[model samples]
Target chain A: MCAQKRAKSDVGEGSPARADLDRTRAVLEGPEIGRALTRIAHEVLERTKGGEGVTLLGIPTRGVPLARRLAERIERVEDRSVPWGSLDITMYRDDLRLAPARALGRTDIPAEGIDDRVVVLVDDVLFSGRTVRAALDALNDLGRPRAVQLATLVDRGHRQLPIRADYVGKNLPTSLRESVTVLLDEFDSRDAVLVGPAKARPAPEEEH
Target chain B: MRHLLSAGDLSRDEAILVLDTAKELAQVSGRSVKKYPTLRGRTVVNLFYEDSTRTRTSFELAAKRLSADVINFSAKGSSVSKGESLKDTALTLQAMGADGVVIRHSASGAAHRLAGWVDGAVLNAGDGTHEHPTQALLDVFTMRERLGHLEGLRVAIVGDILHSRVARSNVLLLHTLGAEVTLVAPPTLLPVSVHTWPCAVSYELDEVLPKSDVVMMLRVQAERMKDAFFPTAREYSRRYGLDRERFARMQRDAIVMHPGPMVRGMEISAEVADSPRSTVTEQVTNGLSVRMAVLYLLLGGSESGIGNQEGQA
Candidate 1:
């Protein structure tokens, strides 16, 4: 998502005011995000038949907290905790040589592991689908899962791979020139989804 | 960042970055499939002109764990034994499109010379008595893991300081990381330029033991010593060796470290080397992680790709 990229760029520069933020529109706010996650939690339980043998694996940066939130929501309803952990896909990326080497993120597997379990790969945004592809490759090295499903807070159109999210918080359609930013209180001090003109040049393929 | 030639080459931030990156890469070794696809299709050539078991194998395993195709080219039975020039051998590797070259040579500055002749990144495994940056890195990694930090930590490096590339590199790196280093050795074994280094020198190991947070014992290179540097090996062990008496003088939480192939009885006691405080084996495991970090940083970037693009322009 653009939020992850934005946070990375903000490291060198003290949070500069971008002109694009002025033209952006907020598609989802804090309360809306909470409700959407709750609905997704219920949907996951229904699909997996009471969420048995389920493990939530969040892709790093923003996806980790998203996965934790989903697990908590599931615990509230089912009176049982679902195993959750973070899976960093930086090593499995196809576009590694395209840019400078990235600092690796943490990958923590729960004690139960992912073997023979349904792994729900969670992320903030569904864009070019390359990150999901990398996640799938990374998961292969971790353990064998019975089935792997995709979950995202926002499912923007124009997926480059033949992948779709099984559980999507919002279906927001936009042009390729627009950037979708997901801000979570766990990272950015607020919860909001914004659609705006590309911050830099128009990114043909938005990196997740 | 391009080549790991010396410990002094890394800034404080750059050094910390490498250590942090190694911390993440260390997790891969514990996974069910202990290989990452980060360096797939890339070739890392281990060109060793010196005989080594631990360092050469560590570099090879590190490269393989990153999924890089590795070619081990030791001097034994290789073209180098037939009098092939270093330049010519480097050129051959360059022509073969090596993405990275890990070199351990008998002559100092061999890795630097190879860097000038090759397009690939050059990693100095151990270049004569010059510097072994990765070994120093693994030492710091092990220390940081045990001590939780390097800032303001007191480290006393004991034994042979003159012929040790590990001692040279560790002094430079530990100083850069804000650790106070004290070199404890006989005046004959200490280098003439010891004062120029950013560390204090001590002749009595016993006096420095209690104040130190880490005591690193350097191997007395018996093979490299042509003349007698000391009265006798037994005399050196009695005066400077980390025996039980000196070990008890150290802080309760102080760690004992030796970059391997140790002259156990001469430099460190057998009991101390096997003690819970000894990080010798942990250093070997950390070496693999540190080398992986170096290779990933040097090859994972788009610098090589950009160089090719510039050539076209």
Candidate 2:
């Protein structure tokens, strides 16, 4: 009976999907993901003069793979390695208590650090711009980069903050009722971007 | 959901999540910058009702390392020593807008009672002999770090189980994580409710030592001993103390562990305590990361930053 109680709590009473998002359409596919990352890699190299002092800090989960893929492409083009690491903005986020608690993701800044370097922050989807704000806050604590730029696979517009991506792969406008989902091989074992209408969020229980 | 009052309060998944989060955050310490902006703009008050330099300092460091504002409140001075009640003290902290409270109290279940008075997260640093949830989390974190896993591991806890909130928390947590536990101590030192705990009891330390993967030596609380739990400290050392010879008899890869503030000769010898297999110091270092994980989870702001990357619409 105690084990049963533990089992229930193990998964957590907190709902993972607070809002039920219904799948509508698949926007980007596996091959398209590969092509988009390659293109972003070239754009990153061109903007910063052949990847000199360039560092790619993925915003974890999908962003990590996107960063790595870009690094590989940049390395091939520039004939030099690009310093890469992961920056987890879980703690820096603004909407922490507004949603169910999320587990912390990996924050690995390279040993040499992001100081005096052109650091490119990579993420899968760009939405409310709050995540980018949190990422900026997280980067400030690490070390001041020479210049910090944002890159994303999709920029589904309705940004709450005045933040905008530096190198956006696709500028797909999204509605308030829809959610953008980015599935990466590193996490979901597949590469695809899907847009869908959000199902009604369960009404939170009323306090007595 | 808002408080960590006991080890049993964490489900298997929550426990693992804390450990996993600690594992990720542990990398932060390795970096030259050794800081994360996770808890910035947050206030964490270490309201220690008991005298504890290590636990309080560890929590303070954890909060600061995460870039959170920390206030170290000790019961030694201030209104607490002026006969002010715990409720009033808590209310004062609440009024100050404490985002989280890391409390250590002399009374059992003080953390639980404090949870009722505060809207912020309450963490039981060590509440009498009831539970030290973070300590247990760190112990298991150290165990998992050394053993690479906790499943099916043999852990023999020695010395003062009766007065140990660490032992109580460890037994519950380790059992939940599928580790077999055996409490090796004098029958007198064992609690009256020991039989109900999810662990085995053994008076023969030598017999249990050979089969154990982790031998945890708890501090013999001389202050708490009203009656003679054993004949003498010398006799207790000869029979149960982890001397070099006794340590040699265990599995070669077997590690020695203590929860700190260890009595050098009474429960564990200096040789065994300082040996390569000992994780006493690692337990302290791991304590910082484990406490950071707890504070992050409870006051970590949003639960939306984990596993699944996609947030709500």
Please report the candidate that would top lDDT against the real structure: 1
DockQ of 1: 0.56
A132 in model 2: Cα distance from truth in Å? 1.7
Tell me each candidate's RMSD, in Å, in order: 3.2, 6.2
- Best-performing candidate as measured by DockQ: 1
Write one digit per residue (lDDT tens) for candidate 1, span A8-65.
Answer: 4312111224665688788999999999999999999999999999999998778899
**What Cα-based lDDT does every candidate model obtain?**
0.86, 0.81
Categorize the docking of model 1.
medium
lDDT of 2 by residue, B1-313 (tens): 3778889877788889889888877877766578876677889999988889889999999999988999999988789889999999999998999988889998998988888887677888998888898899999999999989999999999999999999999999999899999999988989899999999999999999999999999998887778878887899999989998999899999999999899998889999999999999999999999988888877775442222111111
- Cα-based lDDT at residue B152, candidate 1: 97
Query: What proportion of true contacts does candidate 2 retain?
Result: 0.65
